[model samples]
Target: MSKVGAADPAAVLKSFSSHLIAQLESRPVKDDAERAAAIAVAKARTESTVGVLLSAAEVKALVAASTAIGVTVRQDFGTRVTDADFAACTALLESRALDATLALANTKAGLSALRGVVAKQGAVKAKLDELTAVPVDDALRARLWRVLEAEPFDARATVAFVMHELGGADVMREWMGTKESTSLGTHTEQVIERYAKERAFHDVKAPPGVRLEPMLRWMLTLHDIGKPAAVEHGDRNMQHAFTTPVLVELSKKLGFSEREIGLMRAVVDNDAIGETLHWNVNRDLDDAAKELRALAKEVGMAPGEFFELQSLFFVSDAASYRFLLERIFTTDERGALTLKNEKFEQLRARVAGE
Candidate 1:
């Protein structure tokens, strides 16, 4: 039964929610090709749901597979354009050059080149197919590449498009793989470890479980998928921190559960460790407020901030972050890590403590 007496009329009506729903509905639903890509990811990730929250590698593989299959399909069904056709077309344009016009020849050449490129199995072939997938004429498609090649845009559409083909989550992960450690990763891991410590400190004897590790790991990996578009392709270092529209779309598309997405966004929104803790305390006014406040002070923040920070700390996976850190940074004699050495010690201590 619906709560009749005191429900907010706005909650019931949800004008903004309805509008968002409608906007989402208006978009083209993922076709079989996209769905198959998504399903392939789901299978690889062992996710129960049927969707496209694949890693960048998985998306790349899927795109390659799909493009290869698409090429075969087109080859089987469509007439193969020959070099003779292109020559004849070009000849039409030149009154005496070849008896074919350049325009017609260019068209024939473009079509044939497209087929050839699509049929070939390689990086360039995949990129060309992706580029051609856009709804535009052959001339404009060719022009797009020329413009991109001549002067790369600050936000290189080719990179973005290729990355998009790779899929958002997968691309972001790949981007992260290339960078040394992301500051966001540092801040996130620190926050989680701190929270884990605090939680242990409060309980004093409890083990670290109850859905924290997987949750946090997922959060750190996913918090920045939308950053690229948000920062408009700024330095690779800074993109992870920006809150782009792509993040939201990715959150919706990826197989992450709703709670996971919420928690992931919570970390992204409160990305800064200090700010996150401050928010935590402010949000809660319970008996542990004193403890949280004290903890916040230790971390160099107010009590309120400490509580808010706790939620963020445990919001994602400390263990996974630690693993990545360990994997990325080999330990030395003192068990001290090499790269991001200072940050590593901080995290090491936090993990060691609990």
Candidate 2:
């Protein structure tokens, strides 16, 4: 085959990415017509089927290039698709395509390119964790994502907040063995459940009497902190494993307590459980239960305690469950996402409101 197609996807991507970014930088699209013509010419120069698999750093570099031209990739980068071949990345042509990708949202191959617009790192002007939510859900979705995109939180404070609230003495005592957990703890492909029996959970609430909003907020911000390292390892999915040690060292340097440190380790270690299930969409009840139980054992928790604490990571780990209905395969396999547990539904709805 050609040198660019299969032989060197990264090189091919770099060449095309430079061209795309350069077009906007040079002439600059001052209106819709120019925007359409520029990207279309760029798209036509390469075969529609011609695309590249990117290393995490490469993808980030592409994103940076895209951003320099004022392309709003925050929505694209902020969102994760289970199986996104990154079809959207291949072409940055239309306006609506920039809106939330359709059936793509439901598929494992789902990854997004851009959304409405970009604003530096984005602003959390309102308490978007609550979805500020006066507008329709789609509008709210974009707005809330901007909330997650804000990357200016105090690294130490965020770590400390997480350790102080979720990582406790009890959690510490429970943090024995502590085997490393994979991003999608169960490594098959897809979380095989037609309908999730576990009432779509979202751990968005602050604890009983404490001001734990920051912890919850950080859950949104910090879950994927190790992505840069994960990408360096050439697998974006491995961020969870990398995040554990990365944060542990950061916490230690920040002077957190050992109790907090140990529990912090546990919390970050298993943060990928939700997304693992999200990206992979198998519905074998027996298989899922087995995976869940196995994960608990790996982390030295009785299955009960594991389930209880998983909520902490579900929010931090990934928002896959919160937005489950948007997934194409999820709806296809399960008809519609469901849960017998009213409590879980209530919790998820309060935060997600989707």
In order, candidate lDDTs are 0.36, 0.38
Error of 2 at 102 (Å): 50
Candidate 2 segments whose C-alpha is farther than 4 A from its true place? 1-221, 271-302, 315-317, 320-325, 328-354
Model number with the top TM-score? 2
Any idea what lDDT model 1 has?
A: 0.36
Regions of candidate 1 where Cα sits further than 4 Å from its true position: 1-215, 227-232, 235-244, 255-260, 275-354
Candidate 2, residues 207-326, lDDT tens digits: the string is 234223332343333444444445555665655555554445544443344544454455555433343344454234344445556655554555555554555444222324334434
What is the Cα-based TM-score of model 2?
0.30
What's the distance in Å from true for residue 264, model 1? 2.6
User: What is the overall TM-score of model 1 with all chains considered together?
Assistant: 0.26
Worst ten in a row by lDDT for model 2: 187-196
RMSD of each: 25.2, 20.5
